[model samples]
Target: MTANTGFLERTFKLSERKTDPKTEFLAGLTTFMTMSYILAVNPNMLAEAGMDRGGVFTGTILASIIAMLIMGFFANLPFALSAGMGLNAFFTYTVVLTMGHPWSYALTAVFLEGIIFIILSFFKVREKIFFAIPTSLKNAVSVGIGLFITLIGLTSSGLIVANDATFLSLGELTSRTSVVAIFSLILMAILTAKNVKGALLYGIIAGTVLALILGVTSLPQGTVFSLPPSISEVAFKLHWDNIFTLDMFSVMFTFLFVDLFDTVGTLTGVATKANLIEEDGNLPGVGRALLADAIGTVSGALLGTSTVTTFVESASGVAEGGRTGLTALSCAFFFFISLFLFPLFSIIPAQATSAALIMVGLFMITPITNIDLEDFTESVPAFLTMVTMPFAYSIAEGISVGMITYVVMKLCTGKHKEVSPIMYVLAIIFAIRYLRPILPF
Candidate 1:
């Protein structure tokens, strides 16, 4: 081998992993294709919260590139990081819009969440928390987030609209935006059924084209490739004035909770697919991987975005024979190149991105099958968690109610042994939070 090839092989331990450079590169490319829809979706979501669209676009790319590199070189794992979808939804819809906090305040919460995550990872406290939450509630969180995201997509696409009578009703199905979104959703389903790579990306492109044809959106006036927009408008804009408020603490904790479970779930699920789980039922080098995720969230907040976490789409790379950090390295390179393609990504209208959000929601809800429906003790809390998120329009609320119910159900049924100490503390905390409004503090 040439010197460069020899060095890469030694660094990534390609021989020990039983893989080569070509296979790793191919797997990375496949992974990028599947998840690159984030390039179009994230900026649009953040823009709704009054952020600079161009700046968020640039920040998203930079944060993703840096995080993936860390995952490659430091963690030496085939995982990719990006601004998480459900977390971003909470950032935009719940924190900014619903709660009336400024975007900078939300950024501060994310930054704090990252710092705490780093400390927890170092102490191995994150794993303890992970195992403390019941499996049914864990699965319910995913399902709830999925429904919440789908609601966002439907409203954004004008497929569903607010009504004074029934609260929410269908929009004009004949409208151009709704038509394109429906078409894209159908196309994505067909492509996914056919086992097509990059199905969501393809759906977004087709939706954009249909929108252009229908005059729902217009084409960009400039070159497809250009210098990335300046991130000065959004970068490092954390607001500290409200940092000590109870609301801020709750928001930060929610960000911490969601990101913690999401990262652990993605890592464990994908690592299992790659057969990286050891005989002791633990993943080797997971601390480094969690550290990489923590650092990514911190950097992403500083760079102006939502909490960053490991993407489940990395399973695409693992499925394609990626077993080492080389795959992550290759995927990072693609994100670097995409920085200059802002014009193309910017022109992808909300209707097109709505399709991707809805499809992602569908993917996230698959864990619902794992929840045991026969046991009301387990199923009640899980069902409440699944329904509360979309109905209440809050991810944090779903988690709070679920925990409170789970602890109550177990205690009342004389199954209190199943509830961990950590869980009891969380349930008490959430209960007090709910009662705070009436307590005249």
Candidate 2:
């Protein structure tokens, strides 16, 4: 083979390719379905926070397509990338609502944050952050996020989480929206259980079909959704008005830190679980993955959305037959195509995507096995992290509780000697993070 052909063969793994036409197509579809719900919900959530509707519309398409493409082309990990749950919620409620910052300022924050990440990534400074985390805590955080994402699905789907007094609300099951999502969940469960190829994809297709047949589609008909319109609207905010306020700066770092570490921790855990690391416990593409993530955030900001990063749902594809970069690329292709098919995305009921999320959530249990059950110190903190994230509806809270408990557990068990000095610094930092919003400065 010529050098060019040989290089392509190796990079794409063409020579050793195990082309499962049925499986690849399913993997592509599953990636698309994983994000279908977000296409609408993200915009809806942001729109409620005073974000431009056109910005919302354009940002989702561009960020989704750009993020997926970068993840496919550069990171070469089976995971798909996008603006994640915690960061988006943080952008909407925390920065905009609680902190009272404008969306334009938020985008400026995102752009600056991305630049910081890129600079840190190039020098490998981010590696120090990873080293600071104990393996035990890392596993716990991974499983905790799994719980966090699951809780999001449960609450959002109106599954009626139990309240303190009456104990249970049956959610909005009878509502047309909830009904479609529920049915999608059922369909996805059956297909996945039966080991059907692309079960998640099929479930999404079925759900989309059901939604369309029932007239659930919300995209205006006969309108072409292309690049320029989206470019005009997305993460495009530049607020000269609040450009130098203390509150604005405060929101910027908050968005930056939360988004930065959350992405790192989530990626580390998923990568570890997937055996994406080598025997030395090193991740070669980890820097590249982080770069892709940081760029995704910058792109989202440019397009007029909140912060963007890698979504853990890509783990679902990994759990399937997505053992190569090929899978990531396939996912990217579909995400870009969905731009033109925006109407289809808006129509697919949340329950259908819930099906994928629920199944993927279940798959997130791999990290539980990594917990050291024999060590109560490790076990207690790990369990608390997993439990609190979902129940409290806050990933930050879950992590806070975990950090405090881990520190206490280590000291009490006479294992404080085992903790790293850097871990001590982070423990102090996480404590401060927890206190910032509540305490009077």
Candidate 3:
């Protein structure tokens, strides 16, 4: 009836989702709460590579905002984008710290990978590669990523910790952080059980309130509002000299591999749940989504951060009934809000957000029941893909192994015709990835 309402509907197809702007806004807030941890965590990880912490912090936010807006308007998807967690860890711990490369060089590699991704997306090769993946493996990636997300939550919430004897043991139940996280989880479960709207959002706020009361983490001491950090230190600081060297090849390839699988896996997992997957098992506008990710990665490198990719955290929004780009647009607005409210946003301790991630993981696991494990041919590869993600601590590694095993099993079981040509190419790539450890330079 109103002009503004008509504009909103036309832009995001609100009627198709059967959702209003109010619900989409709430869903976006919920997604942002679950993923806001990256704002603090990504910069810290890059700082280990000798990056300017303040500069990285600004870069992270800028990259996320840019990518999410692209996803909202161009891709018209509900997914959110950010400097990815595992990819950043690998960029710091592996590329810069262990390999003796300067931080700028690593940043250059990320930029190159982004450029390559954009080229692939333009040619539609990225979409084809994703579509060639077997449906069983796609389902496995979803379940595997769900388990990986759960593992992250449990660790971040202090519910699980390293043990000298058993590798992982239960954290102290009496610890303030763990207690707050457990309470948040229970509260969310109850709310969800009661069919309450915005249960995840409510749970996160409650957890943060409890943390402030318990002092598991301290509140910010400075002024409530502060200016954005300067992006001068690292912006456009990429080291182009080493871009063509053989030593940079492995780093670039790893970045490319990890990002490719992570984006595909998130898109696959999220789109499948949203019923946006086509009858041919392809995601609509996936090329556009890949392009958004590529652009994010390039812009992140320019501004100073690691590879930016689609986040699995967006599933929280989808679970909350988000079905269009409006959710992503709303999330971008909150990210902008966070730029000035860092103190307030920073006070919401990791334990609070961990509860949201754990709950979303629980929501994602329901799809696993759709997978038929009765046939060993399908189950074996799927099982490897599902379990390897959490155990190996790499989504790309899980996808690689699952894809390799899927192709191998097909040939071994006399179902060679079932294998796609692209699958064979993936198998070789995975083989090369695994062999990198033993290869002599």
Candidate 4:
């Protein structure tokens, strides 16, 4: 091996994980393709909250690059971090627009949440919570995230649409987007069945080509590369005027709560799918991963975005044979390059990536067989964890519901000994969080 190759092997332990540079690079590319939609989506969403669109765009990329690099170099995990989808919506719709807080004020809340996360991670509080989770719940989290990802794919490809009457209904199968996504899914399935490498990546490329041919998407009209926009308007713009108020606490708590469990769920689910979890049900280097995620959130808020957490799309990489931080390093490198090639990356239609997400979802759900079905106590919470994710459209909510139900089931069945102390505390905390909306206080 060359000196550069040897250095990389020592840094990321590529051989130790049974993944070569080629496979890791391909996995990272697949992951980036599946999640590159955030480049457009995050800026657009945050702009609604009165933040500068260009600044938010730049901030999003920078934060992702930094966090992903940390994940690669520090955590040695394959996960990619970025501005979270649901948390961004809350920052825009619920925090600023609904609560009437200034955009700067909202950013402050996010910053505070990150600080708290860092402290928790430093103390290994997050790690303890992770280890405390039951193996059944962990498997269920993987299954739940699978369904959630598939739901996102279906919606993004226009195969699923919101219905005014029944909540969700199927879209026209003949539509260009849905047709392309379906074709890509089939192609990927064939490739996967044949044990082909980079199946998801090939499927996304094929789908994008088909989308262009069918006029569902178009190539960029001008030069594909350009300088990124300035973040002067949004970077370091947090406000402290409302920091001491009850409203601020509520907003920050919401950010912390969602980000905390969301990161936990993503780590649990994706790590499980990657087979990184040990026989004892703990993931090695997870504390470092949580610290990386916390740093991402803090840096994201400073740079003008919402919470930055691990993307479920990283599962696409794991599904493609990624097993080390080299995959994350590849993603970080591509994110840096994207600053100049945003237009090129943007041309990849959502329908293309949707197929990859759906395929990754299939890979993630395989752990369901590990859950004990004969035992009602274990099966009930596990089943709830699997179904609630897609139904509630929130990974954290699925985990919260699962934990609460798991605790209650164990306690009522005279099996409380099976529940860990941390699990009990977490259940009570989640219960109070849910009840806060109904509480008079």
C-alpha TM-score for every candidate: 0.74, 0.85, 0.96, 0.98
lDDT of 1: 0.83
The local distance difference test score of each candidate is: 0.83, 0.70, 0.89, 0.94
Residue 359 accuracy (lDDT) in model 4? 91
Supply the TM-score for candidate 2. 0.85
Ranking by TM-score: 4, 3, 2, 1
Please list the Cα RMSD from the true structure of every candidate, rounded to 1 decimal place: 5.0, 3.6, 1.6, 1.2
Instruction: Write down the lDDT that model 4 would get.
Output: 0.94
lDDT of 2 by residue, 265-373 (tens): 6776566656665554456577777888888888888888877877767666755556555666777777677667666456666666766777777777677897798
Off by over 4 Å in 1: 1-56, 72-113, 231-289, 304-334
Query: Per-prediction count of colliding residue pairs?
Result: 0, 7, 0, 0
Error of 2 at 8 (Å): 6.1
1-441 in candidate 1: lDDT tens per residue? 899889988788888888888878877875676577788888899999999988998898888888888899887899988999889999999999999999999999999999999899889887665556687777787777678768878998899999999999999999888999999889988987887756676787798899989998776786888888899999999999968999999999889877876687567556655667565446667888898899899999999999989987776576567889999988888888889875665566778767766776776677678779999899999999889888987666777788899999999999999899999998998898789889877
Over 207-290, each residue of candidate 3 has an lDDT whose tens digit, in order, gives 989998998777789787998899899899989785777889989998998899989988888777777777778887888999
lDDT of 4 by residue, 1-441 (tens): 999999989999888888899999999999999999998999999999998998999999999988998999999999999999999999999989999999999899999999999999999999999999999999999999999999999999988999999999999999888999999999999999999999999999999899989998899989998899999999999898949989999899989988999999999999999999999999999999999999999999999998999999999999999999989989988888999999888888999899899898999999999999999899999999999999999999999999999999999999999999999999999898789999997
